[model samples]
Target chain A: MSYIMLSYTDLLLASLLLMINGVLSVIFSLGLLKRLVIAVTRMVVQLLLVGSILSWLFAAPSPFWTLLAAFVMVAFAGYEIVSRQDRPLKGFWSAGLGAGSMTVASMVIVLLALTTQIRPDPWYHPQYMIPILGMILGNTMTGVSLGLNTLTNAVRREAGAIEAGLILGMSRHKAMQGVIRQSLRNGLMPLINAMSVMGLVSLPGMMTGQILAGAAPQEAVKYQILIMFLISGATGFGVIISVLGASLRLSDNRHRLRLDRLASGNGK
Target chain B: MLEIVNLHRPGLSPVSLRIDDGECLALMGPSGSGKSLILRAVADLDPNEGRVRANGDERSQTPAPLWRQKVGFLPAQPGWWGESVGDHIEKSDSVLDLLHKLHLPDESLNWPVSRLSTGETQRLALIRLLAHAPKVLLLDEPTSALDEEARKSVEALLKAQLSNGVSILLTTHDKKQANRLCQRIFHINKGVVTEAFS
Candidate 1:
C-alpha cells in the first residue's frame, strides 16, 4: 500500500475549517476567537518549523543534530512544567531540575526502546530518534506538570494536617506519603483513562495516522500498543523524578516545609 | 523539663522561661498578643529566632520531626486527617482507656472524623497528643471548644499526664482555668512578657 501525500492546496483547503471555527467562536461570544487564532497560527508555524528541521535531520542523520533537537524539546518541556507549577521553585532551580529530570528519564527510555526493540539501522538514526524522543518528552512533561501542581497545592492546603503527622513522630517521607500518593495518581489518571477507553471511545492520533498511511489495522494496533506502553512508563518516571525532587527541594534537612521559595500562589 | 531562651519575635519581646517536670505554665494574653506564635515557636512549627531545650537537648540540635515528637503541639483548632478517627490513632488497647477518659466512646474511634463536633475533636486531639507520650506538651486553649463538664474531664486527663511527669506550656484567656492548672502564670500584652503578681 502506498501513502498518499497531501499537496499545498490540500493543506490550504483543510485550513479553512479552522477559520470557520474562529468565526463561530466570535459569534457565540465565547471570547475564544483570539486564542483560537493564536493556537491555529502557532500550530501551523511550529509544525512547519519542525517539518523543515526533520527534513534536514533525516537527510544527514547526524548524532549531533538529533541530540541538539532532543535537548531543545526537553528544555521547552521543562519550561512548560515550571510555568505550570503553582508554587514554582525559585530562580533556575524550577526549570533546571525539571528539564534535567525529564530529559534524563525520557532519553534513557527512548534510547532503550530504540536499541533493544526498534533496532534502527544506526542506533542514533534521526528518523526514529527525534520523533520518539519528542513523544516521550512531551507526554512526560504533561505528567510532571500535573503531579507537581497537585503536590504543591496539596502541601499548602493540608499544611496543618501534614505538620500534625510530623508532630506524631512521623518522618518527612511518612508525613508526605498521602500527598505523594495523591500527586502520582493525579499525574497518571488522564493516561490511565485514555488507555482504558482507547479504541472504543476514540482512535488515537498515532493509530489514525498509521491507518491513513495505509498500514494494516493489525500492524497499526501493535505499534499503537507499544507507543502507549512507552508513554505510560515515561509519564510515571517523569512524575516520580519531578515530585521527589520538588518535595526534597521544598523542605529543609530537618523535615521542615519551606514553601517560601515558591514564586507564585497559583500555577499559570 | 523545658527551657525557652531569648525567644524573640517582632511583636513578642525577648522572653525566657522554664517549666520543671510535672509543672504547667500558662501564658495569658489578649487576642493578637502573639501567645499562639510563642507556643508555635517553642514547638519549632514556625521559624523564629529562639532556642528551645527539651530535657537539656537543644531544638536546633535535634531534627524537627524528632524534636516535635518530644515536644508535642496541639493547636487551638486541631487538624485531623484520615477518613475515620481510628485511621489517625494507633490501634492499641491503651487508646480505649484514653477515649474513655476523654468522654469518647470506643465506637467513636471507628466514626468518621467529619462527624465529630468541635468539642469532640478538641478532646480527641488532646488524647492524640498524650498517646505519643511526649515529654513536653504545648497546648493552645485545649478546652476552648468544650463545655464546663468536658473541660473538667480534659483537665483531669491532663492532670494524669502531669502526674506522669509531663511538662506543659499552655495558653488560656480564662484566668480561673489557668489558676487551676498552672503553677506559674505569665502575662503578655502587645508581645511583652511579664510575670503575673499572683
Candidate 2:
C-alpha cells in the first residue's frame, strides 16, 4: 500500500492547525508569537524551494545536477556551522575551514557508503546518493559546529591552563590536547545519545519518514540503521577535522595562542 | 646571567635589570603594579616592546616554546590541569627524588590535582618548573600561599637551585622574604622601579 499524497487543500488544512499554536502563544503572552510565525513562514518557503529543485533534478537524473545539488547542500551546511560559532575564526578562515572540513569528511563518508554498501545502478543514482549524502552532511554539520564552539570558547577560558602546558616544553598541539579532547567528546555526545535512545524512547526521523512513504517496517529499520551508522561515523570524523583545523588557526608556529585572530562576539 | 633590556608593558616602565649566575633578584611592588605582567613579558607569554636574554641568548633567537621552557615563569596562583599531579611533570623518573626535597611523598604523584592543597599545588608547580632545569626562573609569589614551614622548605630548595648557577627573578610583597632570599632588591610602585640595594 503506497502512502497517500497530500494535495493543496490538505496542506492548507494542515497549515490551519498551526493557528491554534499561534493563538495559544498570543493568549499566554509567550513573546514567541512573532518568531513562531516567521519561523513557520521560512520553513514553508525554504522547503518549497528545495522541493522544487529536487523535483526537477529527480526528473532529469543527471550526474552533473546530482553533484551540483549535493554541493549546494554542503555549502549551506558549512555556512550554518560558521554562523553558529560564538568566537569564530576571523574572515574567510571561519567559513572556509568549517566548510572545507565538513565537505571533505561528509563527501568521503557518503561516497564510501554509496560505492561500497549501496552500489545502486549507474553508481551515481540521484535517488540513493542524494538522500544519503544529505543525511550525512546535515548531521555532520551540527557536530562540527559543536566542536568548533567548544574549542574556541574553552581555549579562551582556559588560556591560563593551556599557557601553563605550553610553558612546560609542550608543542602547541600537545598543549591543546585537553581542550581538544573535551570538545570532540562534546561534539559527538548528541549522536551517541541518539544511538542510545533509538527505538526505546522514540522512533527516529529517517525511520518515520521511510515508514510514512510506505516502505515495509523491516526494510525501513534496516535503512535507518545504515544511515545512523553513516551519520555517526561522518559526524565523529568531521568534528575532529574541524576542531583540529580551527585550533591550528588559533595558534602560531611558536606555540602561542593568537586570540586576536578571532572576532570578539559570537556569531548568530 | 639574565638581562632585561627596556622591558615595557602597559603599567610597567621600561625596566632594565641584570641577574648574574647563582644570584636571586627580588621584585617588590604593591598590587596591580604590573609585577606579574613583567614576569609574563620576560617569559614571552605576553606582548611587550622589550628584549629578554639568558646567558647571552636572546628570547627572539629561540622559539617561544623553547624560550618559555628555558625561562620558566611560575604564576602566583599556579595553574594545574590533567587528572593527577604526576601528569604535569615530564621525565618523572629524573624528578622523582626532587619530590621528597619539597616534602611531597611518592604517592602524591598518583593523587588527583583536585585533591591538592594550594600550598601543595604551588610546590608541585615549582617541582614541575624545575623538571626542565630552566636557566632563568621567573617566579611570581611562589610562596604566597605557604605557611612558615612550607615557605622555609621552598626557599631552601630555591636557594639550592640558585647555588647550582641558575638565575632567579622573583616577585614578593613581603620585605622580609625578599631580604632573606634576594641578593638584590628592586622596589616597584605605580609601574616605576627603584633599586633598594645590591
Candidate 3:
C-alpha cells in the first residue's frame, strides 16, 4: 500500500463520482429524479456551509457553540420530519421528546464508549459530536415520522371500534390498543428489516466511510457494529415514546378523542 | 319519545317529528332525500342546525359519546376495524342472546371478521349494536344487503327487542318490510319528512 497526499485531483475525482451517480440515476428513470436532484443540491449546499463553519470551530473550538449547533440540527430535523407528514404540526411536544431523547442517548453512548479515552475533548468536540449527533437525529426523525403517520392513520380508520370500546366502559387507552399495536409494528418494521440484513447484505455508511479514510477493516467493522446497535436502540425508543406522547395529545381530560386537533389537511 | 326540531338540510325548510317510546318509525325516501341525514343528526354524528331531544333530554346536555351509545346508529354498510369477531364484541349477558336472535352460531366468536359474509356481517353488526342496549336504534337500510329469509329473521329480531323499551327508527325502500315492521311511517321526498302511513 502507498500513501498519497490529498490534492485537488481528489476533489475532482469525487465530483466525477457524483456525476456518474447522477447519470445512472437519470438512466434508471426511477420517478424520483426530481427528488434526487433536490436532495443532492441541498446536500452539497449544506455540507459546504457545515464544512466552512466546522473548520473555523475546530481551529478555535468552543464547546458551547458546538453543542448549540447540534441542538439546532435536532430541532430543525424534528420540524422537517413532522411537517412532511399528512398530519398537522400542532403537536410539537412529541417531536421534541423523540428528537431530544434519541439524539442525547446515542450521542452520550458514542462519546462515552468509543471516543472518551481516545479524544482529548469529550463533551462538545465538533469533530466527534456533530457528525455522530447528526446521524442519530436523522435516524430518530425518520422513526418519529413513521410512528406518527402509522398511528394517525390507524386511529382514523378504527374510529368505530374505538367508539364501541368506549361504550363498553373501556378507557381511551384500552380502546386504542389494536391501533397502537399495529402502528408500532408498522413503524418498527423498517428498522428491524435493516438490522436483520446488515453486515452480510450491505456495508453500512459508517463502515464504508471509515474504510475510505484509511482505517483498518476490522476497526471499521467494530465501529459499524457499535453504531448500528446504538442507532437501532435509539430508533426503538424514539418511536415508542413519540407514539405514546402523540396519542396522549389526541385525547382530552375526560379521555374523549379531540380528533379535531389531529385532523389532516383542512377538515371538512 | 324522540323529538327532532328544525331538522333541515341546507336550502330546505326545517322539519319536526315526534315518535313515542317503543314505536317503530320507518323513514322511506329515494336516494339523497336526507333520510340517512336525519338518523345521523339524531345520533349526533353530523353537525346540523337543529335540536334533538331523546327521552326528554336535550342532546346538548348529554355528551356526544354518551348520546351515541344510547342512540345506536347503523349505516348502510357496517364499519369494521377489529381482527377477530370476538375482538369487536365485548363481554355482556345480552350479547350471546342477541347473537342467537340474529341467527349467528356460537362458533362465530372464534372466526376472523374477514371470513364473515356480507349478510352475516350485517347481522353481527346489528347484534353488536343491540348488545350495548341502546334506548333508540337508528337503522339506515339495516337489512338492505340480506336475502328474504335473512331480512325476515332480522325483522323478527328487531320486533323482539322492542319489548325492552327500545325505540327503532328504521329507513328502507322495501314497502312490504316497512308495512310489516313499522307502526308509523314517514316518507321523505324533496328533502321533507311527511307522515305517509300509520
Interface RMSD of each: 1.6, 1.5, 4.2
Give the count of colliding residue pairs in each prediction: 1, 1, 0
> For residues B92-124, what per-residue lDDT tens digits would candidate 2 score against the true structure?
675877888888888888889888899998999
**What lDDT would each prediction earn against the true structure?**
0.85, 0.87, 0.74
User: Which lDDT tens digits does candidate 3 get at residues A189-231?
Assistant: 8778888888889878988888878889898898777767767
RMSD from true fold, candidate 3? 5.5
Comparing candidate 2 with candidate 3, which one achieves the higher DockQ?
2
In terms of lDDT, the poorest run of 10 residues in model 1 chain A is: A259-268
Prediction 1 global C-alpha lDDT: 0.85
Candidate 2's C-alpha runs over 4 A off are: A61-68, A114-129, A216-219, B3-17, B28-33, B47-67, B83-112, B115-120, B147-153, B174-176, B185-198
If you score just chain A, what TM-score does every candidate get?
0.94, 0.94, 0.81
Q: Give the clashing pairs for model 1.
A: A86-A267
lDDT of 3 by residue, B1-198 (tens): 688888765633577878778888899989888888787667755445688888888877876667777778787767665788887787566787777777777878778988889888889888878877788889989899899888888998888767666888999999888888888888987677755767
TM-score of chain B of each: 0.96, 0.95, 0.93
Which sequence of candidate numbers ranks them by lDDT, best first?
2, 1, 3
lDDT score at residue A207, model 2, on the 0-100 scale: 89
TM-score, each model?
0.91, 0.83, 0.73
How far in Å is the alpha carbon of A167 misplaced in model 3?
A: 6.5
DockQ of each: 0.58, 0.53, 0.19
lDDT string, candidate 2, A123-161, tens digits: 888888888898899889889999999999999988878
